[model samples]
Target: MTYKNEQLSEEKVFKDPVHRYVHVRDRVIWDLIATPEFQRLRRIKQLGTTNLTFHGAEHSRFNHSLGVYEIVRRIINMFEDRPHWNKEERLLSLCAALLHDLGHGPFSHSFEKVFKLDHEQFTQRIIVGDTTINQILEKVSPGFSQKVADVIGKTYKDKLVVSLISSQIDADRMDYLIRDAYFTGVSYGHFDMERIMRVMRPIDDQVVIKSTGMHAVEDYIMSRYQMYWQVYFHPVTRSAEVILTKILHRAKELFEDGNYTFKLEPVHFISFFNGDVKLDEYLKLDESIVQYYFQLWQDEDDEILRDLSERFINRRLFKYVEFNPNLQMKEWMKLYKLFQYAGIDPEYYLVVDSSSDLPYDFYRPGEEGERLPIHLLMPDGSLKELSRHSDIVEAISGKKRTDHKLYFPKDRIEELEDKQLVKQIKQILYGQGEVENVR
Candidate 1:
């Protein structure tokens, strides 16, 4: 049997809370899942620091990857007998969905920011480079590895296949919304996914929802909207992320300084500190390894490193005040110096984190990463862009919203010897002398 057509005598099933049962029939997919690189995903958290907020969000990328693969599997199965859907692209789409998140490291956002790395680029490297995933794909066909990479990269010749995994409403988003919601124990990500999938139709290199499924599509869009603000961009979660990012920055700074010494040498981070991380070195990092370094750094002589590590390890996150940097530069600068005078290291303790979303967007020809707008296959045998028919989607379409918060250790501020300094900081933050009891 050819590698693409190779099937297990009995389908292997992974019992998933989100999808119920993820069935694996293709030998290549089953073998790929067994690879050490893919197995490493089990160690990486799906929601990163979100578990700190939503306690139940301890699910890993291994869970999410499998969910995504199952989603695409069902999607392709529905498309199998439809016109304009290439039967040959079935394996390619499934493979891309399964391995799309393979390159994500532990605490992905913070690590990528401090180290100047891109997980998507790493994903492509894993698929096309000398990795086990590449070998598996190459075993299927000589050029299949590159083809998988292209799909993840969104540069594949088949836009239909690319849309299945990378587009705004693709399998990746569909799976994560429900999976993350399930693990986070939130109601915001729930939608009629089965109904939406049933109405999915491929036309002219893109997938469209039938007009009859428009309500289901709206619910999915609204669910995404609520999930973004309620869970994905929760302020408390961002606080933890801020501390995590500062911890990484402090470690790198201490490593660069000639005077400081670490209790445990950060062998895994040396290349990252030097800004020349190789793929092998990158692959070696996971949350456990990072936590190990954080634990050791908590005992280090560097005060900043020690304190930040203690905070992150113990869930002592910074409190935040809403502030727009673009409009409040002068206030931000004043707060910066006040933090220094108050004996707080502004660099590590004070941070501005921003989260933005273009909840639904139609194609803007010249824009980078322009989404192919969701289309509704009307009963009249015509296609209509999503916003044109759905009033709720139209209101949010093409609109971008951003929220920025200035994070600081409120506990340290409260302990200041000079109550006057604390009062002034409160005045700047609250616009009045009174500080609200809100954390």
Candidate 2:
């Protein structure tokens, strides 16, 4: 329980843009990050294909993970003598913060979509299984690894501790919201994090914002709302995702047809195509490995695979236009045939992309997967649900902001060799000579 034994011989610092610096004085935290498992994060992008849109968003999960750890370190510092927040829980929170994204693979969201892999499960494996993370965790105590894993799993029984890492507005979200905004260069994620931390108080089982800090809480909510629409749900990012999805689809088809011979078989992709990938192989993958395959596939004999990979790597993103979702089936068929007649592959080049997100929603009586409502402690010691207090949250609750876009290659259409067919297809998409401005 003494501080001297836990201190490192010299301070260690990781230069970070979000947290400014990730300082380490404990040997345990340092060793865990050095593990091959943790080092793999360097190859995994924090925002996935968002880089295709925001060129500056090339920061990795390694950056965000360290930022989260630093935020948790600060939160723990606020609890030095607070009730319900034992000083002993400090290391567990830090460990949970560092390992939260341990299982995230290359192009995380797209990979999870195609392979049905859960990064959370892999996180637990790295912590409790026979791995370097597990070994370092066990050094503190035989059962410490499980404890850290439980916190990440939100099964640690201490709601205050769980809230620090996994809450609706905890260290993870706080760090990422600002960190992502910083990298993406957006104004939506600038909240008063220092003020929020200053006002945080550990309650009976969960951490609550003090009544005096309600404005800060409202600012956080608005920031999240802006980020969800402005960055996380950007249409250009979705265009890249659409292209990535098509690439996987084409690769799977080639693998099935046996018409293609890869210079090297995408061994990592095989299990994904087969719908059963193992953890070790998943760990072996990162953005680099995926990009390596993408680079080689650009030369593939299969036109679809070659074209999709080229578009992804070269950032020839799909162009999008506002779409009407309630159109008749006949209209859909007409558009498909029009695209085909224009010599464009309707399957690969034409897509309808729709995205929806609710910034804040109060728990409904019969709602499933309902989030635990955020509460603000009133000056009189009574608690009020966030929506009941903040009109901004009330306006946002139950309102799902959705965007529908029809994607196509405008460059290809503009250069089409068949003038008449191009004219017809253009007419189907744009009534006369101009596309509809749905915005």
Candidate 3:
């Protein structure tokens, strides 16, 4: 038997809260899972700063990665005897699904934004570079490692495999939606995944749902919409993200100034501060390491660094007000100046954050990041794009929605020595009357 086809004497199963049991029968898949690089995902969060809002969202990327692998495994099993299904691609698909998120750093989104790094590129490196994962993939075949990386990058020639991992409704999204919802303890992520998966059929280069499963598909789309607004884009989560971003900014600035002294030197951050991080340095970072720095920086002499570190470590997130830069530029400037006058650094303390989503979209041939439209296979073998038949999906198809909020420290604003300035800020934020108790 080929290395890729080698199965264990007995199947191993991992009990998962979302998928019940994640089974591993292939020796290659099991070996990859045991690698140190793959194990590192246990230290990184699946949802950055979201746990601050939904306390139950403390699950790590390891959990979600395993869930994704299991979903792909089930999909491949169903496709085993079907026409146009390539059994040769089975191991490749499973390895790609399991290792897709291997390179995610601690608080992935915020870290990427602040450091100008791409986790996807790191993932490619871990797969193709000289690493344990690469070693195992090489055992399968000299070229197998590159194939798995190409699959995750969406550059693989097998359009069918690419669609399985990345299309509008694929294993990655399907797993994360349910897993995130389950861990976050929210009702929005629940949907008939089994029904949808059962109806999935591979036709041409894409996976299509049978016409009978249209309602389940509709429910899945609606569930995604609710989760985006309710859980993924929660205001409190954004507040924590804002503070986290500011903390990184302040630390980088202080490091470049060449005069500030850190109680614990950010050995892991120097390469990042210089804008060229080595893979080894990057791999050494996780949420625990980041928090360790935050804990020590709380005693730093720089007040901004110390204060921001304390806020993040202790969960003292910023308070936000609804403010649109397009409509409230003058008001935003007024607040910016007022904050500076009040001894709070406007650049660090005042922030505006925005979140946007395109609920669903049909294929736009030449568009960048174009999503392959979800199609339904009719009894007569005719295919129809989803939005054409589903009213709820049609209402949101191709529509982009965005929301913005202005964040500031409520404690600092309330304790200002100048009451008139505080009153003006409050009036602008909460109308022309006394500041009501708002949570």
Candidate 4:
């Protein structure tokens, strides 16, 4: 049998905590799962550094990728005999979904922010480059690898297939939401996923929910919204991320200085620190490898590098206070100057981090990074944008919310021998003995 038509003799099932079971019967899929590049995901965390915050959140990208694949598989099964669902693109969709997060590195956002790398770009490169994944894809047919890349890249001619993987309510988000919720042991990410899937209809170029499932869709949207604030954007988790990012920054700064002696050479990070990472070099660095480097740097001579490493390794995370950048610029500047005077590098010690999301939005022409809005397939076979049809959705749609926190080590500030300076700093962070938290 041709690889395209090949099926396994027996269905291989993975016992999944969230999906119950991920079934694999196709030989191509089974083979893709066994590829070295795909296996690399097993070493990368699904929620980078979040395990520190939520002890149960140690799940890996491999886990999330499989959930995505299974979701798309179930979706395709429902779409097999339905209109506007191209069965010809089934394998392409499955392949894209399975390998969608193939390029994520260890501590993905920190590395991306520090090195200016885009995981999605790396994902496409892995598919098209001279890798085993590319070889397996090409075995199905010539240029099949590129087709999968385009699907993941959102540049494919088949918009319906693209929507399955990249839309506002795609399989990726659906899987990550419930799966992250499951692993993190949170109740907020739970929603009527099965009902939403049941009512999904493949329109000309998008998937629309049956109006009967509008409530389920609203639940899903709210689940995503809450998950962001309560878990993904938890201040403690961001504090961990802040330290991780600062570690990378310090390493790169030391690398550029060109005179730092290393107890153990940062061979895995040399290319990343230089901002000229190749695919092979990129693949070699994962969470385990990065953690090893972080461990070694804990003993380094550079004070900033050593302190940040020890803090991250030993869980001495920074404490945060809500300081609105717009209104507190003067306060921030004063604190920055005081930190420098107190012998701490404000550039590394005093940092502000922000997270923002627009729960839902209808399309606005000529906007940057525009997200397509969810649509409801009305009873009369007409389409209506979700917000217009549901009061719950309308209330939150197109409303962008941002949360900002200034992260600093409260320990250092509290331990300041200059008690008067410590008092002054505390007053700015905590006005009237209470944090000015912005929710």
Candidate 5:
């Protein structure tokens, strides 16, 4: 036994676009990745319905997990000889970073929003509870699993390990920002990742960027802001979300009404409808299962369910126009009334979508800010908050960008037999009636 923990006999490599290749040296990390539960991430899309908007965004959570792991591996390599960076915690940090998104379910965000599920809690359950992940984690040590969980939960005592995974400018963000940009074919996410990696240093339990790399950090922050508005919060994506939400609502209502019957109870949906879901059932539910049910519902007797499912699956997304939350109130009300008159349900067919995100935020004392602020290490060994050092971060700090749009079935309205009514609705929506008659 010549220090067997050094490396695996057969090195494992996951082909990844973001990091090029995810290399596994420790047997523990290799075993964890081989677990069946981890394999399930292959089928779960990282961006979910965003693929419908960005055709190239078909990458899975498996892709992201490996990318995160690779970034952590590189950062830890940089910290090997540095102060405050423990060699003991190396595997734990990589494990935590890799499995952070393991608990994400199918269409995670929309599903969680509609059903009140927290993926983070589910993540802990999968890691510490009885499952392949738990077993794999326990292989390292009984207490080891909890340490990995704690790092992801952001409750770990080691500030350095927690910061690497959960901090504002950590491996998770770094991987996603770059990976998402590459897959979506956008130029905004092209920050100098190599420079950022080189600038990282571990100092007394906190990781900070070297002041020389402030420009690289600024580019990363700006890139994140651009991606949020350009891709993550696109109005079209929100429109699909609205439709998915209404689909869930309709299914729940039909279940409650007790008049309609489903071919199957859709057991996975039962808990969500009843507002109590179990982790095992949630884990079993992936995008394929959801799409399977949607396909089945297409043949259901409920016209609303069938139609909406078809729309979602077929990319018949609602068209939208910029809406003013303040000035469009009356117009929105009139559009609601007109929808009813035109036999379209305003609740399902007409929607106003609003999305806002803060790309960067400064520390606000006693406020509800969750993420720790990014810090840059000055030459004299003192740390400066990122916004204070970088002009790009200063410009975007604490400024939340918001976008609003009113979504409607442009196809339906265009083809509406009642041309005059359609004209009026179009006038209210676009401020003029240039809409062509539904041919």
Candidate 6:
């Protein structure tokens, strides 16, 4: 048998906490899992700094990727022989779902922001570059690796297949919601995924839910909204992320400084600091390596790098107060000046972080990050947008909410011998009446 069509003698099953079991049969799938690039995902946490906030959230992207593949597998089985579903596309869909998150690096979002890297771009490169994943995909077809990249990148010819992995209510989101909820020990991500999958119909170019399953989809949407605010954007987790980002920033800055000398070489970060990271260099970076660098930097001579690394490794997260950058320009300048006067580098110490989400949105042409809206298949066999059918979904549809906070090391501020300067900073952070109450 050819490699793509070959089957294992027995089904390999992975005991999954979220999906219970992830079954593998196709030799191609099995080989892909064993590849070094795929194995790298085990070292990258699914939630990044979220584990610091929710102690139970130590699950890795390896777990989430398997959950996504299993979900698509189940959906494909249900789609067998169904109208508008071509069985020829089954393997491609499964491959796409499995490899969707293959490119995320250590502390994904923070690393991306500081280095200006897109994990999706890296994912495509890995699939098409001279990697084990690329070799495995090429065994299936001459340009099969590119096909997988296009599917994950949302540039594939089959919109229906793409919808299964990249849609507003696709397998990727469905698996992560339930999986993250389970790992984080939260109820917000809970939703009846089975009902939604069962009622999903393959239309010409999209997957639409049967109107009978509208309530289930509604629950899914609300669950995503709640998960974003309550769990994904939890204040404590953001504080940890703030410290992590600052650590990266400090390390990169130090790397660029010719005068600075490190006790230990930052070999892993050289490419990232120079902004020309190659694929091999990127694949070598994972959570453990980043953590090791942080541990070493804790003893570095650069005080800011040492302090930020210490804060990250020891969980000395910055305290935050609600900040409106637009309305508080003068107060912000004064705060910056005050920190500098007290020997604190406001560049790293005072950070304004913002988080925002639009729970659900209808497509608006030419808008940035436009997403296809969910559709419901009515009993009359006509398609209607989800917001038109459910009041619960409509209420949050297209409404964007944002949060802004100024994060700083308040403990350091308190340690200042100049008590009067501390009071002034506190008054700026907290109003006059609230200043005395602060510890």
- Candidate 1 residues 1-439, lDDT tens each? 8878999999999999988999999999999999988999999999999999999999999999999999999999999999999999999998999999989989987778888888989999888888898899999989999999999988899999999988879889999999999988889999999999999999989999999999999999999999999999999999999999999998888889867778778999999999998888888899999999998888888888899999999999999999999998878788888889888999998899999998999989988877789999999989999999999999999999899999999999999998888888889877784433312
Off by over 4 Å in 1: 433-439
Candidate 6 lDDT over 348-399, as tens digits, reads 9999989999989987889888989999999899999999888998899899
Model 2 score (lDDT): 0.84
Every model's TM-score:
0.97, 0.93, 0.97, 0.98, 0.94, 0.98
Residue-pair clashes per candidate: 0, 0, 0, 0, 2, 0
Q: Using lDDT, rank the candidates from best to worst.
A: 4, 6, 1, 3, 5, 2
Candidate 2 has a TM-score of 0.93
Q: How much is the lDDT of residue 92 in candidate 5?
A: 90
Considering lDDT, which of the candidate structures 3 and 6 is the better prediction for this target?
6
Cα deviation of 225, candidate 1, in Å: 0.5
In terms of lDDT, the poorest run of 10 residues in model 1 is 430-439
- Please give, for residues 93-135, the per-residue lDDT of candidate 4 as tens digits: 9999999999999999887998999999999999999899999
Error of 3 at 164 (Å): 1.2
Evaluated at residue 306, the lDDT of candidate 1 is: 90
State the TM-score for model 4: 0.98
Model 5 agreement with the true structure over 178-224: per-residue lDDT tens digits: 99999988888889999999999998778889999999988888888
Mark the 10 consecutive residues where model 3 has the least summed lDDT.
Answer: 430-439
Model 6 vs truth, CA RMSD: 2.3
Name the runs in model 3 displaced over 4 angstroms: 433-439
Badly placed stretches (over 4 Å) of model 2 are 1-5, 327-330, 433-439
